[model samples]
Target: MIKNIQRTLIELANIHRFVMRFYREVFMPPYEFKEIIRQCYVVGWKSLPLISLTGFITGVVFTNQSRPSLAEFGATSWLPALISIAIIRALAPLVTALIASGKVGSQIGAELGSMKVTEQIDAMEVSGTNPFKFLVVSRVLATTISIPILSFYTAAVGLFGAFLSVNQNENTSFRVYFDQVFDAVTFLDMFSLVLKAVVFGFTIGIVGCYQGYHSSKGTEGVGRAANWAVVMSMFLVFVEEILIVQIIQAMRA
Candidate 1:
């Protein structure tokens, strides 16, 4: 038990060092703008279709499930505001991050892990290249910038799905439903969404890179790195969500 705890602590310390190195390298010299843009396209644009489908389904299912309860309480009219708050404040960010952790995070880990196991990363370093900056920094920045935009897109799509459900059941007009949604959502909610998205994005990117960069030798190690990246990213995302929610609630109080 003590050995296990010590291993965990050591891993955490290594991760902290990796993150600090990233911070230092990110601002140094030749910014890989081209690589960053490419990664953004790969991470952000490639993710849109899945995000859209998931967001729409999530909104529809959540609305359908919540309707009966609200109807029972004669609060069906509050559906728009309720949906808006739920989606914007929590659901969108959480869903987006989870999906990205599974999708983008795993991809990054596997790609980098493969490069590492094959000694491609070593070759780059041996050459005049700053492999960490070119690879890790660009990908991390891509995830960080892309996720907030994706979260906003998810929230919008979710609201649209909710609107469809509400219109079918309550005959609420589009404008009226949207107006109510806007009315209920404050600056705090928007701030929370952006903050959560950015933090989650960073967590996913950093964890994936760390796992891949430090993966063991062999093909099995590549698979293990990818798996660990997804698991760790999702776990950290949940932890961050809980902490952020607590902080937000405290601010609200």
Candidate 2:
């Protein structure tokens, strides 16, 4: 048990060092603008369809499930406000991060692990190229920029889905439903959404890159790296969500 704990601690320390190095290299000279843009296209644009689908489905299901409970208290009219607040502040960010973990995280890990296994990364180093700066920095920076944009898109789509669900039973117009949603959400709520997305994005990128870059030397190791990337990214997302929520609550209080 002690050995296991010590190993975990060591791994955590290594990950911290990796992250610090990433921060230092990310801002150094010779920014890879072309690579960053390509990564952004791959991460951001390629992810929209999945994120949109998840958001819409989440909104529909949440609205349908919550209606009965609200009806019990004669608060059925509060559906839009309730769903909007929940989706914007929590559900959308969490769901989007998880989805990105499965999609973007896995891709990054597999790609890098493959490169590492085949020694392409080593060849890049021999050719006077900083592979870490070119590959890891661009991908992580792209994730950091992409997730917040995806979160905003998810919130908008989710609210629309909620509106449609509410309209099935009542005659709430788009303007009225949106007004309720906007009224329920404050600046604090918006700030929380952005903050969570940024943290989650960073977590996903760093964990994915760390796992891939340090993958063992085999085909099996590549698979392991991809799997670990997704699992660790999702785990970190929840941990980060908890900490951010606490901090936000304290600030509000």
Candidate 3:
């Protein structure tokens, strides 16, 4: 068991190394622009509705849940401000990261894992086509490109949801609610939030490709890779968030 665990770790590390090298190679000659764009459509645009729906519902629920607590202390006026802080600073990015990790990360892992099991990747290599460059690089580039757009859409929809929820009790216009919301935002908030989302996207792609590429060539191995990709991405996303928040706090001080 210990040997198996150790070997798995080593395999994962090697996969990461290959992915990074492929990423470097990707930017070089004979760029696979078409494949990258196709991946963007698959990983980004297809996933937009899911991210937007999740973000909107989350914001709406958060506002509804927190209203009574704030109202009890006669703090109703702070609703808009708190909602903005939550979305712009933490909630928006965190939720969007989770969504991307599941959608993009799992898809990358499963797709590569399937190809690996079917020997298609080996076939590409034999045919003198760089499988790593064609597959891994395209997906990673798609992920990196897609995440920011997804976050922007999610944040906007989430704030809109918050507005709808606030209207449940408060009699504020959309403009007024948004004014309070955006009023609380600062460069520190936006910077950390956006930076974190980008990193989170990179993490999802790297980890997913790593697990899938190195998994043994079998259906069971493919399933295991897919499962573990989601698990590891979630863990990494939280770690990144904590580190980012600490850095932000330090900068503030």
TM-score of each model, paired residue for residue: 0.98, 0.97, 0.93
In order, the Cα lDDT scores of the candidates are: 0.96, 0.93, 0.87
Superposed Cα deviation of residue 64, candidate 1 (Å): 0.3
Judging by lDDT against the true structure, name the best candidate. 1
Report the lDDT tens digits of candidate 1 across residue range 116-233.
Answer: 9999999999998999999999999999999999999999999999999999999999999999999999999999999999999999999999989998999999999999999999
Query: After superposition on all CA atoms, what RMSD does each candidate show versus the true structure?
Result: 0.8, 1.0, 1.8
lDDT of 2 by residue, 32-69 (tens): 99999999999999999999999999999999999999
**Global lDDT of model 2:** 0.93
Worst 10 residues of 1 by lDDT: 207-216
Q: Give candidate 1 misplaced runs (Cα > 4 Å).
A: none
**Which one is best on TM-score?**
1
| Residue 117 CA displacement from its true place in model 3, Å | 1.0
